[model samples]
Target: MSENWRLDPDRALPADAEIRKQARAIYDEIASLPLVSMHGHVDVDLFAANKPFRNPADLLIVPDHYLVRMLVSQGYTPAELGVPFTDNGGTVAGAEASDVETDSRVIWRRFCENWRLFRGTPTRYWLEHEFAEVFGLSAPPSAENADDLYDELTAALARPEFRPLALLDSMNVEILATTDSALAELDSHAELARTLGPDRIVPTFRPDSLLHVRHQSWAKEIAQLAEVSGIATDDYAGYIRALEQRRRAFVAAGARATDHGHVSADTTPLARTEAERIYTAALRGEATAAEADAFSAHMLFEMARMSTDDGLVMQLHPGVLRNHNARIHEKYGADKGFDIPTRVEFTRSLQPMLEEFGLSHDFRCIVFTTDETVYSRELAPLAGAYPSLRLGAPWWFLDSPEQMRRFRESAIETAGFYNTSGFVDDTRAFASIPARHDLARRIDAGYLGKLVAEGRLGPDEACETAIDLTYNLPRHAYARHERNA
Candidate 1:
C-alpha cells in the first residue's frame, strides 16, 4: 500500500484496462468544466461575509453531519467531536454533555485517531481529496502527525486566498444554490447577488416546515410566513396566497427552484372544504396524524399548481424519516445525521399531480428518492412518460459510486439520458462540493466507457452523453432561473 495519502488519477474508474482507458479519455473531456450546484445546504452568508475559515476542525468536521454522524456511530459522542449542544436549560444527561472537547487540536486528534474508521467510505474519498488537492497534505492523517496537519491546515485557512468566495472561484463553480426556508427574507442572498453577480449564488425555496402540519413548528412557521408576506394566513385561501407571494419574492431574488423533503411522494389533493377544515383544525391544534398527512399531501399538489403558474422548477425527494433518534434530536437539533430512509411508492402517490401538469411544457418536476428499487420499477417509467417529470440523480445515502452506476444502469433503459436531471452536490460542507461532483463525473465516464467497450454505444455518442451529464443537463434544467436572473 502507498504510505502517502495520494489520489489516483483514475480513481473510481473501471478496473478493466481497456474500459479504464476509454473512461479516462471521457473524464479528461469534462474534468475542468464549470460546476453547476443547483441544490445544497451551504449557507449563503459564507459568501456574503467572505470570511476565512476559523480552524481545521471547524472547516472539516464541525458542520458536516455526515462526518459527525459516522463518528457518533463508532461510539464517539458529538461533544467529543466538537459538535455544539443545543442551548437548552440542562435537558440532556451527563454522558451527552459532560466535559465537551473545546480545543480544536483535541477534536482534530480524535478525528486523526479514528481515520481508519472511514477507509472505504465516500467520506474518506472526499476528505483525502481535500487534504492532498486543496491543502497540499502529502502524509495521511494519523495520531502521530495530527498536530502537524492541524498547523498546516490552520495556516492555509488564514490566507485570504482560502476565504469562502475565493475557494468557490478556485473550485470553478459557476452557479451555486442554497436551500432557504419559506419565511426567509434572503437578505444575505440579495447582498450576494450584488457582490458576486446574481447567477453566482441563488436561493432555493424549501417549505418543508409549512407542509408538515403535524410538526410542532408548523403553526409558528405559518405565523412567520404571514408576517413576512403581510397577508392573513387564518384561512386556506389566504395561506395559499401568502405562500405564492413568498415564492414570487424568491423568484425576484434569483431563485430557480423550490425543494420539498416530504416523507412520502403523496400528492393527492383534498377537496377544498375538507382542506379548509383541516387547516382550521391544525390552527386550533386539533388535527389528527391522519389529517396532517392528508393536508400535507394536498399542499404538495398545491405547490405543483403554483410552480406551473410561476415557472419555478419543482424538486421533490421523499421517504426520509427525519430525526429518527429522539434523544439525539432533543440534544443536538435536526440534521445531526439521524435521518433514515424508508421505502417509497411514486406511481400512485404522484398520479394526481402528474395527471394535472405532466404534459405541460412550461412546468418541470425532478423526483429524487433514497429508495433505489423505485428507480427502475416506478420513477424511470414515470419520468419517461411525463413531460414535466425528470429523474433526479442518486441522492443522499445513494450518492456513492456503486449506487450512482446502478442508477444509470436502471434509469437509462427506460427514461434514457435526457429525462434525468444532472448532478447536484446537496452538501453543507463547502470544500466537498468539487470532490462530490468530480466523483459523479468519473463514475459517469466509467459507465459510458463500459457501454462503449461492450459495443452498446459508439465512442462519439458516449463522449457527447458524458458532456451532457456533466455540464449541459444541469444548465438546461436550471435555465429558467438563470433567464429570470
Candidate 2:
C-alpha cells in the first residue's frame, strides 16, 4: 500500500464485513446527492464578492471555532492562530500578551504540525475530507509537510475554480440558507441572488440580538432595527412591529426559515402587560437578568406566533452556555469557541408554546440541541405528538459519527424518521459544508444498512429512506418548495 494518506471508499461505513458491504451499497446510492444546507453561518459576502480565499489558515483554521477550540485546549491561543483582534487590539480582560501571529504561513504551520492532536475527532475527519477530496492532497499534514502543503494550498486558492462562488457549485449545494441578523440589510444576499437566481442563496432570519434585552448591544440593535424597518421603536408595541417588519423583509429576500438560539428552551408566555413592563424596564436599563430571561422566553412564544402567520419554518437551537470563558469572550468577541453545552429540560420549557401552536397546520418548528439526554426522553416524545414539531439533526457537539448513530437510535423509535428534520450543517466554515454533509449521510447509510441486514427493513425501503434523509426531508422541513414562491 502507498504511504500517502488516502480516504477509504467505505471510510464511515459499518465495520462488520457483511454489514460493511451493505452500508457501502447504501452510501453509494446517495453519496452524490445535491446538498440542502438549510441552516449555516457562512458569511453571505463570500458569495457576493466571489473573492479568492485569503489563505489556507483563514479559510480553514481561523473561522472555525471547532478547530480553534481544540488547538486552544492544547495550549495554543487564538491570537497565535491568526485570529484577529476584535476588542481594542486584544487589550481586553484576560488577554494574552503574546504577539498575535499575523503571518498566515506561521499559523498554518502551527496547525499542520500539530495534526496528530485532532485524532478521533470530527474536526480531523472533516479536515481529512477537505484536504483529500476537496484539495486533492496526497498526504496528511504533519510538521514535515507543513511548508509544502501551505504553498500548495496557497497556489490552489489562487485558481479561479477555487473561489467561493465556484466552490459552491463544485460542492453541488442545491440551496444554502445563511443565518443573518434581523436588522441586516441583506445587501450581500441581494447581490448574490441577482447572479445565482433567487432561493439559491437565501437568508435565514436570526433575531437573537433583539431578544436578549440586557445585552450591551440590545438598545443599539433595537435602534438599528427601527432604522432598517422604518418603524420607530420608542415603545414595546413599536419594538414588536419593527421585528415583524424585519421578518417580512427577510421573507421577501427569499428566507424560508428563522433560527432562534437560546440558553434554555423556555417558551413560557407572559401577559402583555408583564411583557410591556419588562420591555420598558429593559429600555430604561433597569431590567434584571431574570427579567431579561423571561422576556427572551416570552419572545420565543411571540416568534412562534409570528411564524404561524408568515409561514417561515422556525428552527430553535437551545441549551448553550455562551461565553463560558469571560476573558476570551471579552478579548476575542463572541464565537471564539468557548461555548459549553448544558443539560436542557424541554418538556416543561416548551409546554406553553406546544399547547398554543403544536397542532397548527400553518406552524412548523424544527428543534435542535446539543443535549442528547432530551433526544429520547423529552424532544422525541414532544415531536411525536406535536404535528408542528420536528427533531433537528444532532448538531454542534453531538454531530460526530458515534453521536449521529446514537441520535438515530434514540429518537427514531419514538418520533420515527418523518418527524425529524433532515441534516442541517450548522457551520460557519465554508469548506466543511460538504464534508459535514457527507459524514452525516454515511452514518445514516450505515444505520440503514444495519436495519436491512437485520431484516427489519427491506433493501428497497432502506434505499428510499437513504434518499429521503439525504435530500427530500430537508426540503420539506425547511419549506424549500415555498422558498421561490
Candidate 3:
C-alpha cells in the first residue's frame, strides 16, 4: 500500500478476488520474459557515449512525450517540462525553466509533488513499474522521498552496469532493432557490433526523411543522400538510384527493413515519363504543392518496387496529420505529440500499389495506421487478400492496454492472428521498452483468458496463442521479410 495504488492486476482485469489472482499469474509469467524490441528510436548516441544519466527527471520525465503531454494536459507547458525549443530550423535549444535551481533533485521534487496528477493514467503504471522494479524503489515517489529516490537512481546510474549498453544486457534483450535513416552512416551500430558482437543492436532503415515532401530541408536532404551513397542526384532517375544506393548501404550496415511514413496511404505507380517530369520539377524546386504530393504517392510505389527487388521488409506507417499544432511546431519541432490522427481510406489510396505488387509472394510489407476505423474497413481485409501485406501492430497513439485489446478484437476476426505482425514497442524511449512490452503481453494474456473462459478457445490453444503473441510470431514476421541482417 505504501508503493502505489493497486490497479487491476495485469493492467485492466476486473478486480475480483479470483480474476485478479488469475491475471497476476499471467502477468508475472509474461513480465519476466526477455524483451524483443524490433522497432524503437532510442538514441544510439547514448549507448555510444555510455555515460551515466544526468539525473532522475532528465531520465524519466524530460524526453518522454507521454509524460510531457500528460503534464501539458494539466497546464504544464512543454517549455515548463524542460522541452527544448526550435525556431523554424527544426533545431531545439534553450531550457524552459529559467534561473531556478536546475539540479536533478529539484526537478524530481517537482514531479514528486505533482505525482497525484498521474494517478489513474497508464503513465503512472509505467512509471511505478520502472521505479519499483528497475531501480529498486519500494516507496512511492512523493516530495518526501523525491531526493532519496533521485540519489539512489543517480548512484545506480554511475555504476558500470547502469550504462546504456550494460543496461540492455541486464534486461536480456535478445534482439533490438533501432530505427535509423536510410542515409545514415550507421558507424555507431557498426562500432557497437565490433565491440559487443553482432545482432545485438541492429539498424532499421527509416526513409521518411527522404520521402517527406513537406520537409523544409528536402532538397538539401536529397543532396546529402547522394553524397553519402555516391550516387548522382541531378534528376528523378538519379534520386531513385541514390535511394537504392543508400538502401544497400543500410543493408550492409545490418538493416533488413525499410520504413516509410506518409501523410496518407495514397500510392501511385505512374509511367516512367511522368515520374521523371515530377522529379524534374522537384529538382528545380518548381513543383506546386499538389505535384509534390502526387510525387510522394508515386515514390511510395517506387519504394515498393525497390523492396521487391532488394527483399527488404517494407513497413508503411501512414495517415498521421503531423504537427497539428502550428504554434508547437514553431516552438518544439516535430514528434512532440503534436501529431493528430486523420481520416484515411486505404482501399482506394493503396489500390495502385496493391494491384501491382500486393499478390507477390516474394514481397513483404507491414502496414500501420492511426486510423482504427480502417482496421475492419480496409487494413484487415487488405491483409487477408494480399500475400505481400501484413498488418502492423497498433501504433503511436494506440499503444495501450485498451487499444491493444481493441486491436485484437477488431483485427483478429478478419485478418486472423497469423496475418498480422506481432507487437513492436515502436517507442523512442529506451527505458519504456520492457514496460510497454509487459503491458502488451499482459493485455494479450488477459484477452486470451477471456476467450478460454468463454469456450472460444481451449486453455491449451490459448496458451499457444499467448506464447506466439509474446515471442515466436515476431521472429517469424521478421524472418518472413528476410530480416536476417
Candidate 4:
C-alpha cells in the first residue's frame, strides 16, 4: 500500500482521450488568468498584518474546517487534533471541554497519520495541490515524513517572501473580497487596500448577525451598529438607518457586495408596524422564535431594497442547519464543523422580493444553495427568468470535483453559464485559495471540453467561455469595475 501520492496534471479531467485533450487545451488557455475571488471568508487581518505563517499545522490544519470536520467524523476528538474548544475556562479533567492541545507538532502528527480519511475528497485534492505546487513537497504527508515536512514548512514560512501578502502576490490574485461584519471598524481593510491598491483587497458586508431578532447577540450587535454608524437605534427605522450607514462605510472601504447566510431563503416582507413591534420586542429580549423568523425575512426584503438603492450586489446563501450537534457546539462553539446542509426552495422563497426588483437596473442578487435538488428545478428556472438573479456555484458539501460536475450537468441545460455567478471559493482557509480556483477551472474546462467533443460548441468558443468563467464573470457579478463609480 502506498502512503505517498503525487498530483497528475490531468487530474479532475475526463477519462476519454479526446475529451481529456480538449479539456486540457481549454484549461491551459485560462490557467494563467489571475484569480478574481469575488467572495470569501478569509481573515482580512492576515493580509493587513503581513505576518509569516508560523507552522505547518497552523497553516494547513487549524483554520480549515474541511479538514477538522473530517477528522472529527472519524471519532477523533477535536482536542486530540489541537482544535481549541469554546474557551469558557473551567475544565473538568477527563472531559473534552478543557482538553485543548497546545503542542502544534502533536496536531500535525495526528493529521498526517490519518490523512487517508481525506481520500476521494476535495480536501485531499486541495492538499495534493498545496503540497506539490505551493509547498514543493515531493510526497504526500504521512506518519513517517510528518516531522520532516513540518520542519521544511516552518523553514519556508520564515522566509520574507512567504509572508501572507507576498503569497497572495505570488498566487496572482487579482482581487480578494473578504466578508466583514457590519460592526467592523475596517482598519485592517484600509491598511491592506493601501498595500495592494483598492482593487486587490476588498471587504464584503455581512449583517446576518444583526438581522435575526431572537439571536442571543442581536441586541448587542444592534447597539454596536448604532455606535459604529453614529445613528440612533431606539426603533426599527433608525436601526435600519444604522445598517444602511454601515453598508455605505463598507462600500467606501472597497466592498462590492453584501453577504447574508440564513437558514431559509424566505424574503417575505412584513408591514412597518409589525416590523417595529418585532424590533421592540427583540430589544426587550422577548421576541418569540416565530416572530424573529418573520422579522428576519422582512429584513431580507429590506436588504434587497437597500441593494436596489445602493448598488451593492446581494449574495444570499441559505439552507444551512448550523450546529446540528448541540453537544459539539456547546463544548466547541459554533462554526466548529458541525454545520449541515438542508434543502432550500428558491422559487417560492424569493418570489416576494423578486416581483418587486427582479428586473431593476441597479439590483443584482446571487443566490447559493447546498440543495443540489433545486439546481435543475427551482434555481435554474428562477435565474433563467429574473434579470436580477444569478445562480452561485456549488458550495459547502457540494464543492467536490464530482459534485461540481454534477452541478454543471444539472444546471447548464436551463440556467446556462452566464446566468450563473461563475466559481466562488467562499473559503476561510487562505492558502487553499489557489488550489480551489484551480480545481474549479479544471472542472469547468472539462465540462466545456465535453460540449466541444460532442459538437455543441467550437474549440475557440470554449476558450472564450473558459476565460469568461475564470476572470470576467466574477468581476462582473461582484461589481468590481464600478468600485468608485
- Candidate 2 stretches with Cα past 4 Å from truth are 1-5, 88-90, 93-98, 480-484
Error of 4 at 100 (Å): 0.9
Give all candidates' CA lDDT scores. 0.90, 0.91, 0.77, 0.88
**TM-score comparison, 2 vs 3, better candidate:** 2
Winner on TM-score between 1 and 3 is 1
lDDT of 3 at 351: 90
TM-score, every prediction: 0.97, 0.97, 0.92, 0.96
lDDT of 1 by residue, 1-485 (tens): 13466679999999999999989999999899999999999988888888899899988999888888888999998878888777566436554455567799999999999899888888888888888887777588898889989988898999988999999989999999999999999999989998888789999999999988889799999999899999999998899999999999999998899999999899999999999999999999999999999999999999999988888899999999999998778777788888999999999999999999989877889999999999999999999999899999998999999999999999999999999999999999999999999999999999999999999999889999999999999988877743354
Taking every candidate in turn, the Cα RMSD to the unseen true structure, in Å, is 1.8, 1.7, 2.9, 2.0
lDDT of 2 by residue, 1-485 (tens): 13365798888888998788788889989999999999999999888988899999999999999998999999998999988767655465655445678899999989988899999999998999999889877688989889888888899999999999889999999999999989889999888888889979999999998999988899998889899999999899999999999988898889999999899899999999999999999889999999999999999999999988888999999999999998787778898889999988899999999999999988899999999988999999999999999999999999899999999999999999999999999999999999999999999999999998999999899999999999999998987434336
Model 4 misplaced stretches (Cα beyond 4 Å) = 1-6, 88-98, 481-484
Model 3, span 301-343: residue lDDT tens: 8888888877778888988888888887767778787787888
Model 4 scores a TM of 0.96
* Highest-lDDT candidate: 2
Looking at candidate 3, the ten consecutive residues that score lowest on lDDT are 92-101
Clashing pairs in 2: none
Count of backbone collisions in candidate 2:
0
